[model samples]
Target: MNIEVNSQNLKFLECFASDTRIKIIELLNERPMNIKDLAESLGFSSAIVTKHVQKLEEAFIITTESVPSTRGRQKICHLTLESATLQFRAKKQDDQNRYAVSIPIGQYSAYDVKPTCGLASDTKIIGMVDDPRYFSDPEHVKACHLWFGSGFIEYRIPNYLVGKQSVRSLSISLEICSEAPHYNENWPSDLTFYINDTCLGAWTCPGDFGAVKGVYTPSWWKLGTQHGLLKQITVDSEGSYIDGIRISDRTVQDLAIHYGDDIRFRISAPETAAHSGGLSMFGKQFGNYDQDIQVYVAY
Candidate 1:
């Protein structure tokens, strides 16, 4: 996870403010445990530990799931975020030089998804869950959240660069994560990105998130995929980067993008990948970050 040191991320930062939360994190790091077990380990009451758990869950540092136990149902807490990078500085860019657009998650021009896949609008499921044929249902355009165990999804983006506007950099941001059956904090998925067919390298999503409800997700949603990590992929004059870390040597010039060209962006998780856990994409109405796939062309 990569986060900026700013007001917007204060909640996540605050997760480390308390010693109790820190100890809870350390204990969970070794293994997933229920509230009763955690409280006993910390010499605290279940109610007190529950409060601490909620704080960590809000920060996305941990996830909890209700499962059958000897005593009935138990909420087992698991460590979700394995690591995080705190970015205190960012390079300044002129907004005047850029044109941006937000692409809804389901507005894909083409896709090839397998089973354990489905789509959902803010109000209901798009079609049948785990059925690929439903991906083509006319109502798919209304989807705010979508996931697949494997395969790819593509989107067509309009290139708005006008007369002689040479590209400086191209930025794409979205909330995404691994797709596990129900949910799994330890699952990893190798996700690859493409621009007009040019490979931008791949990123390994750490896990499928749903340990708690997403801030923007519908209250009735219980599919286990609550939210995802926000990722920023950029291609500039020098190279391509994911969350400021260079992933590939592919550059804007290498992409050869020109005025009036339609950009085809693809996100895929091939079954042959080392991780192959799958992928889940969240839109403005489905994830912690209330935004769709945002694209920016800077020239």
Candidate 2:
């Protein structure tokens, strides 16, 4: 996803690029610290450390929280962004043309998930559940299945465009649907969306729409029996999107998008739901496509 770096962002990034400032960030990354503790850890004068931290705070790269210190009240500084990528302007060449690039999440070697899940490309499935024990049983492994209680799926996105100059925006797309039997638009499911551990937004999928069946859904499965329905989740600055269209007015700034070495995308439901109420997730099972998630970036 692309974000316009105005004077504010540029200033914050520049301040964070410094050795002393980055050291300060690394120190605070674990927990917030006051100027005195920070200066002592870095062997710098408290005045000098304060001056550098002020720059970061003014740019919104760091934040302060007042707490009781042995010496009285102290203001602790903390890093705001979870991760960041340093984007530079592109080099001028004989050809002045804009290019659109797509990188599959599968190409990245680093990724993790909890409980039970799987990842696959058009070519083959990777990670757990690839064996016939799980795949052989259709009911055991649905491409995308949802439950009433809490469940989560996570993806690790490597900083693919590190050191690149000027990114216009970043866009993430995925096909999602209910994992219950039958369609009912009236049923509301509490679905949460997150990126890099930041809450992007939450959406409740309305009753299932049987008219539009998933491409990979089997006809014998019966209408709304195994999979309620499928739709898309597209999010950017403008707002949260579904099926390539805007569904929420929330923008990218609301989610605090950042450039970093690794980005994490996660979605989950709480265990409070007593029943599925006809909601299911179709990630690897019963879908025509292999990798149901797609992330696009514009620079």
Candidate 3:
């Protein structure tokens, strides 16, 4: 039921335009059901239902997995989209198009200390393990990566849209994931992002993201722990989006980020979150993206 109702990406809305597909979604929403059962419940032939299921699956509105059945296998389908909102437009004609800045992962202006925290470059740890003093060490500036079980890392940057009349959008992209003492693929962390003081949204990183050699992980680094996921989050006048998918209703105005202010970006796993999964952040030299903490602004 939760959807980004946007004016763009018209093709993404095609699957929902059919009556048969609507019924398919309804059935799958209630419970995952195979095409045969869905066809029977909707009073359609199996061939017809199968076709509709294929379309829904392609649109990413539904997902399918094959399971053992008398005939060898049955495809079980489930709805993936909750709902969506319309994206009104791209940057306006007269508006400033885009601005961006890349900050080193360890260059945070302020940070609260917590155990299980450490800073590292692609080659080696900056100092002793779990040491807060190292966070402020001159060597910290050279760090391309770091992690912590809790607490926030805050960076101050210049706002690019001060005194502008056009609607503005802000985005900060970094590679990150849940933290474990070592690597655990099953760990899940609800990491929240903030712009100035507004809570933009939280993305549940599914694991510690280690266990294999990351695409750019140093050869000196050992295996058993992978790198973080490359996530580009956009917060605009309409809402917040992760990898181009809208996640919340908080808009750019809600962020109250002014062009004249020393804009702040903070990331943390709050104690009140459903999962205290901790955090592991990667830098341009360490993760798949080979990029630093990137800030993007657009009209």
Candidate 4:
């Protein structure tokens, strides 16, 4: 996340002013917690913790959801923003040499999935849950969220390079995580990436997060994965990177992409992987980030 030094962003800056909120952020960094848990840990009353939580939520630093509990419904809180950058100066505005494409999560051209798989749109589930056949349903194209126990999904993206345009780097950003029954914070999945057919290596997502509802997740979505970590995978002339850390030696040149070429991207969590935990993808209306599979090409 990026923030500018302006009055419009004062609320976000103010979130860090209080020591109580700072402590709340610290505890949430370890794991998601409810208001009662936070209160107990901070030696404060639930009402005080709730007030602090409201402030954090308003700042878009955290998310909360009410879920069933032994007593009744309790509000669980989850940390949302992983990191933020405070920009002190303006940078050059240049976008002519670059182009971006946003592919809906459900617009995959090919797929092979196992049970515990399903798709959902912003309004409703497309078909029966845990049914792989539904992946081929016509309504699949409108899905904003998708998951499977194992296997792969493939998307064919258009290469927008015009005459004389080449490539510098390709960055694909999406919201993804491991898939488990309902939710789990510790399930790890080794999700591999392939461009065209070349392997760009794999990333291990930590878990299926449902500790709290996603900020944009519909209220009707209950008892399931609520959110995922926003990850950016970039392939440059040097190598492939997840977020900003190098993940493999695969380079953009290796893709051999050209004008009018087809960019077939694949995400797989094969059963043969060490973790084999499964995969889940969240789209604009389902995850914290209001975006689909964002593909940015710098030429």
Candidate 5:
């Protein structure tokens, strides 16, 4: 969805540009904590922390709730934004060019796995099927180790640059593949995707990803073993997409990327479903490919 960053949002970000405020944000990233706990952890006075939190709350950078505590009432603060898409207004001269933002899958902080999993990048291998105690892996995996029910490894794409001007349309792309041992055409794997909590669409990949060689697939990797799913979601009258194919006709407004505090890209499966299959997504499992999520703004 398209979002215009007006003066209000600019002011909102400016509120957290301070050192103290930034520290508070970092701490809250872990989980929601009460003001007393936050004050003790940061070694700051409760009054000072309360003042800063008040400013953050006013700017909508955080939200606070009152809860019962051993010491009586407590204020708990938490971050409201999952990820932000910052669009700086362009100068008149640079309006003709289109700009894009690319967030590599390797940059995610909380890459998790459950039933079975692995992740591989252009540089190294991580999460083997046999090894269960490898959680502190680096960001350069050629393929990832993953499992089911652990939810998806989320990535944040801060709008670095939209060039000099706004665009008529925007597009997003990501390269994905299955990480299963066996390949069957009728396995019925579902990958539910979302943008800013809005369900963009769901893709049920055909089991056999081994038919075609992946674009950046390694030579050592057996062909037809596991190919890749290159899905593209375009924002236009036609709606979202999957692998250059259209799956939904829902409008950009329905996706709600423009209205929210931050734009979050989430992938997860619901509990209730018709087909009871598992998922094995490989972000950068092949050759030199980077499983990147790109935002292309066309002005």
Candidate 6:
């Protein structure tokens, strides 16, 4: 059978094509950095470094998050994969084809949010901070992005697969990072994913994002939190994968999802987490990537 990554695979190669971004990667190989440090090290303007970093992130090469700084929020860029390579040939007879769909960040069917939390659309805040009451506002459906310090949010993935829906595999993609009362470069959070109540696995997000402008972020948003790393969580008979890399033994059969059933995707920052850093999510109208939470079903 054939294989593919979460985002466009070529997008990763495109990131290496840039000389400036290569330098950034090289530096990160030595240590992670914030925008200010990268700018200073590269002798480039903060704006310029931000652009290059975004390109690397779009391709899933590097990830950025915000942390506490004397000047306020600071962004730390970390290297994801040291190096990645690919091969392209002809599609095999057993090659599997798939269908895809996208959901906005704010359109969750249910939510249990807490203080140090709030929601924002592409253009404005959904409601006042720390007020779960506003999460029910009909306007929330229009939100392109949202954030919360603690708790979990769940979205209903619409049933759209038609024909022989063998449902060989299922996947969800989103831009996300750890959340905190305020940005902290060193902050860590254990982010967990669940499908139909089955705990797939947990990924640690270093910190919340802020301090720079997201590529598609609205000007109305202050100069903090551009976006988070674009990631894909997938499940199949083969088990689970994070950005195409195996993370656990949990598989599609574990969830027992069928074509007629509604697929629920939930992200949680439970109290027992080692970090409890919180979480922040981005939508199409926000973040460097111009896509929302994407769901892919391969049969």
RMSD of 2: 20.3
Which of the two, 4 or 5, has more TM-score? 4
Candidate lDDT (C-alpha), each: 0.90, 0.52, 0.76, 0.89, 0.56, 0.78
Clashes of each: 0, 33, 24, 0, 22, 12
Q: How close is every model to the real structure, measured as TM-score?
A: 0.76, 0.43, 0.67, 0.81, 0.51, 0.74
Candidate 6 runs further than 4 Å off: 1-21, 27-97, 161-164
Candidate 3 vs 4: which has more lDDT = 4
Worst 10 residues of 5 by lDDT: 140-149
Best by TM-score: 4
Point out where model 1 deviates above 4 Å. 1-89
Q: Residue-wise lDDT of candidate 1 within 140-252, one digit each (tens)? A: 99999999999999998888878998888888989999999999978999999999899999999989987766767898798898888888898999999998899999999
Ten contiguous residues with the weakest lDDT in model 4: 85-94
> So what's the TM-score on candidate 4?
0.81
Q: Arrange candidates by TM-score, highest first: which order? A: 4, 1, 6, 3, 5, 2
Residue 150 C-alpha lDDT in model 3: 81
Clashes of 1: 0
Q: Is candidate 1 or candidate 2 better by lDDT?
A: 1
How big is the positional error of residue 238 in model 4, measured in Å on the Cα after superposition?
1.7
The true-versus-predicted C-alpha distance at residue 243 of model 5, in Å, is 5.2
In candidate 5, which residue ranges exceed 4 Å CA deviation?
1-97, 109-112, 130-136, 140-150, 160-168, 211-215, 220-225, 243-246, 258-262, 269-272, 280-291
lDDT of 2 by residue, 1-299 (tens): 22235564676667856899989988987777889999999999999999999888876566676779778898778664433333355323322222333333233222222222333322334334323233223333223433222355556654445454433444565445443334554556666767666665666665443433344555444435233333445555576765444556765556544566555667665445443332244444444333345665444
- Displacement of residue 124 (Cα, Å) in model 5 is 4.3
